[model samples]
Target: MTDHVDVLIVGAGLSGIGAAHHIQAALPERTYAILEARDAIGGTWDLFRYPGVRSDSDMHTLGYRFRPWTQAKAIADGPSILRYIRDTATEAGIDRHIRFGHRVVRAEWSSENARWTVEAVHDGKPVHLAASFLYVCSGYYRYDAGHTPHFPGIERFGGTLVHPQHWPADLDYTGKQVVVIGSGATAVTIVPAMADRAAHVTMLQRSPTYIASLPAEDPIANRLRRLVGVRRAYPITRWKNVALSTLIYQLSRRRPQVMKSMIRKGAVQQLPPGYDIDTHFTPRYQPWDQRLCVAPDGDLFTAIRNGRASVVTDHITEFSETGLRLESGAELEADIVITATGLRLLAFGGIQLTVDGRDITPPETMAYKGMMLSGVPNFAFTIGYTNASWTLKADLVSEYVVRLLRHLDTHGYDQCVPTNADPGLTEQPLLDFQAGYVLRSIDEFPKAGSRAPWRLGMSYAHDVLKLRYGRVDDGVLRCQRRPTRDAAIPAES
Candidate 1:
């Protein structure tokens, strides 16, 4: 069956949900649909269920501005955040408009018709839908069959192997030796939580990572939240966390040695008496160089102090019958193994997009304000940087897209395409940071040349001002008139 809509939004996660809210609020008369690949609503939250899974940023900023975060502690866990997203979708009436089990595989833009033809699989059958505009909210390729890196002789290992992305609820870790591989946020979280229930937990990392610890609960903030509404308290709470986060980021950037010393001090306070912070906590790269791991309640550091957990700094040469054999000739035994090796991101629902039959190569395209891509008309994709909350930027982008759509509706135009004037522009990196996901996917993404709109800025303050209140005359967007034959052609008065 074929369906038609004014706008087709892909993915029902934070970004997609945000987009839907803005579009419906701004244009109540216009009809739109959010196509979700999965049966559930929360995208990443629904996908990752590993122990200690949670947001790295504070909830005040991570949550939507329209819906203030009411939680006392700014940092939140997976279940709470998931509930927030699901609740937001329900309250916004977004759930009624979604078509689940519909995995979009491709989208082709027709210049002749000035519409997008999207193809998806529903119930093992292909379905086509057309829309005047398309909005992509599918996050970076973080989910796809959880990544399980193969160590030599892994199949021969006697222990159970799992990836954090696909962690099982029934799997028991009580009194078992658990070894988690990878040093990102997921690994750091798993170590602490597992150490509580397991016989022992060991985190194996080839290199150290910059980890900062904080209390699980904030008392004064909680008091203020109770005294005032969350909306009233949200700004202060968000800024407070932002200020602290920013100060540490700047300290790490300017005074590397000082930041290193401070981090080591925290580690020393929470680790064993003779524990060497330099060997396990001192990262070779600058702090925030890669995303810094955050541990609330100081769980990771607590495990180390209590000697319930330990860190191994060496490459895995192979997997033995019951454990891993390190490249340094040391073998560590474990009853269970988890590969938190990270995620592989897919762009545009892993679908191949084309304009009038010509394929659009995402890596070769230019991202304008980190949202709109050159030559793509009335389309925007939400992608957040390693520094801030993913939802904050997504919410702002949603507002901007809605505004752009409103402008087009009033202007008697059916199309607003962002075409790079200089087709000969060479490709360059979007972000120069050392984030593992960004690093691995950089070569496969659209490059921002040295120019406005085309360049991607990681700063939230800059983007919020530019995107939320910026002008449309920027060289990137090209507003065009509707064709004479279209059904919505403006009346010639």
Candidate 2:
């Protein structure tokens, strides 16, 4: 017999855990199960175990809205964040509802029965699960491998090469010269993180990225928590950070030169005198065109000033036996090369989705409210914001899912599908990000619309009103009643 539930959540990460908590709190009677492909609870936190692995976003906004981050460190390490997520699950007994080692391969939606028949592989055995709704919390990136561009003559290099995603546990780099490729968050994090042990670390980037320095600990947030306690202070601090970040993004977009000058000034103040700020720090694109990389307490700058780390702005010629050859004919010797390139985008955990017998192609479908797809029924997925903290958008998406579920039950409907009836709705890329990883695979993802409900809301303040307080039956999402069959919605997984 196939297992069944009211909702089947396809991940155990922060989004999935938060989604579960909202469902349990709002609709106590509804049954749900979280199917985790990995053996652990913390999804991205668990998968990423490389040294110096930490969140780019601050803990206050990255942490769940319901849970206050009690730790002093605002820019938290990976293990700490993992502990927070696992602890959240354990405290709520959400751990009991997770089915680990279950990798969902495909999902078949049946309109006749108003259910989704999920196919998964668990311990080399096939397992079938039926649910009224499918919630995909599996993140947008390929967990197996990060994006690694082919370096010419890489095979000729005698030194050890490693990707940040699959960092070897026993790989030694003591007193060894290390060269990290790419100027994204991972590259910045790895440079200072490995600088202390390595002889020297060089960050080689094709072009500079917008990097901003933030304090490792937020003194204001800590002070507020101490004075008023976590319950009262969390939301206040959360909103404060949200507003500040939005204002900065707006300023960057509005007055690009002013923002550029300010950022350049900050880099100049932190770096050594006569440093090439224009060549090594300044980015060609406007800030927020790609994600702004964060360097906590100016750690990366400190590393550079101390001569433990350095940045090289140039194109790669090829990999040499000793090190990498630059287009400028300068050769940097390295004992180890770590490719901190980027991630490969994966949609719906790379699961094949079919509506009845017909296949659902993501490129053809349009995103409705940044959560549900326009032609898909009883489905939702979480894709976080590029501008601000990921959890801010994640929390909003989770709350909105609860609202969708409530509407289905309260109105005596089995399914709901968002249909694009507006002829004027112009299709745009789902994510406007220009990162190499995004640009490489954006065509595989769904499209966003030109207007409301169909447009992607990158702003948190706007999403709060639209998602949290917006009307559910807006005539676009058609909730329909099906012939009531013997619905076998189980109470638990």
Candidate 3:
């Protein structure tokens, strides 16, 4: 017999926990359970254990709206974030509702029963469960493997090679030369962190990424907390961060040159005067074309200034026995090399979906409001903003889902599916970001329309208006109730 639930949430991470909280608060009567693939909570935070693993976005906005972050540091480390998540679950009694090691592999929807039959693996056995609605919080990338490009002669490298995604617990780099490949957030973070112990660290990149230095602690936030208290200051700080992030993003798009100059100037202020800013600090792409890499308290630049680390901008020709050899005839000798390449994006947790015996291909389908897929009934997924704090959008998605579920119950509807009504609407890529991870897997995900509702504006203000307060009975959504036995029988007439 299949165990049934009102809502079956896949993944017990940040988004999943938040979703559960909203459901419990808004629709307490509904029965729901979270299925986590891993044995622990904190999803990304728990998985990543590399040196200096900290959030790129500030905690004020990254933290859930319901629970305000009281920590002193706005940019928190992995352990702190993990503690925050676990504490929230424990306090809310949400820990009991999670089923660990249940990795959902397939989901089938039946129109007749108005339910989703989900199949997962647990302890090397198949487990079956049913739910009226399926909430996917599994996130956008695959956990099993990260995206690693094939480097010629990589097998010849004699030293330790590591990827930040799966950092080994027993690995040690103390008093050794370390070369971190790529200029993404992870690379920038690990360079400074590993520099503390490693004799020297070098960041090798083909092209540069926009790097910004933000204070670890916000003076304004601290002052506000002292005056108005943590609870009262949270919203104020969150709004301030959101507004600032939004303004910078908008300006980067509108006035690229001005923003580029400002970013360049900031980088120069942090580094030594003779440092090669053009070679190591400048990016060919416009600001925000790819997500900007943030260094708390300019740690990366400080390491460079102190001669503990340095940056080399050159393409890797091949990997020699010692380390990487560049196309410019320069070779970096290292005892350890770390690949901070990127992630492999996974849609719907790589779960197979079928509707009424028809296989649903994600790329062929359209994403409705960046949450639900067109023609997918009683289902919603969370994908956060690329330009701002992820939780800013995730919170809105959770609230919207709760509102939608309540609407269905109140109206006696068994199923509510968003159908793409406009056939003439042109399809656009759902994620507009040019990050390598996104670009590599964008085609595997669903498409969004070029117009409203179907198109995700990626703007928090616009989403607030459309998702939070938007009508549930909009014509684009088709709501239906299963026919009762008596109603199914033809009228006597």
Provide the overall lDDT of each model, using Cα atoms, as 2-decimal numbers: 0.83, 0.92, 0.91
Ranking by lDDT: 2, 3, 1
State in Å the error of residue 270, model 2.
0.6
Q: What tens digits encode model 2's per-residue C-alpha lDDT throughout 1-493?
A: 2289999999999899998988888888989999999999999999887779999998999999999999999999999999999999999988999999999999999988989999999999989999999999998998888898889999999999999999999989999999999899999999999999999999999999989898999999999999999999999999999989999999989998888888888899999999999899999999888988999999999999999999999999999999999999999999999999999999989999999799999999999999999888999999999999989998999899999898887877888999999998899999988888999999999999989889889999999999999999898898877545424642110
What TM-score fits each model? 0.95, 0.97, 0.98
Per-candidate Cα RMSD to the true structure, in Å, reads 2.6, 3.2, 2.3
Q: How do the residues 215-264 of candidate 1 rate in per-residue lDDT, one tens digit apiece?
A: 76666568778889666777777767667777877788899889888878
- Residues 1-493, model 3: lDDT tens digits: 2389999999989999999999998889889999999999989999999999999999999999999998789999999999999998999988999999999999999987889999999998999999999999999999989878999999999999999999999989999999999899999899999999999999999899999999999888899999999899999999999889999999999999999999889988999987789988889999998999999999999999999999999999999999989999999999999999999999989999999899899999999889999988989999999999888888999999998988887877888888887868999999998999999999999998988788876788888888899898888878877545235642220
**In model 1, which regions exceed 4 Å deviation?**
422-426, 485-493
Clashes in candidate 2: how many? 0
lDDT of 3 at 146: 88
TM-score-wise, the better of 1 and 2 is 2
Q: Between prediction 1 and prediction 2, which has the larger lDDT?
A: 2
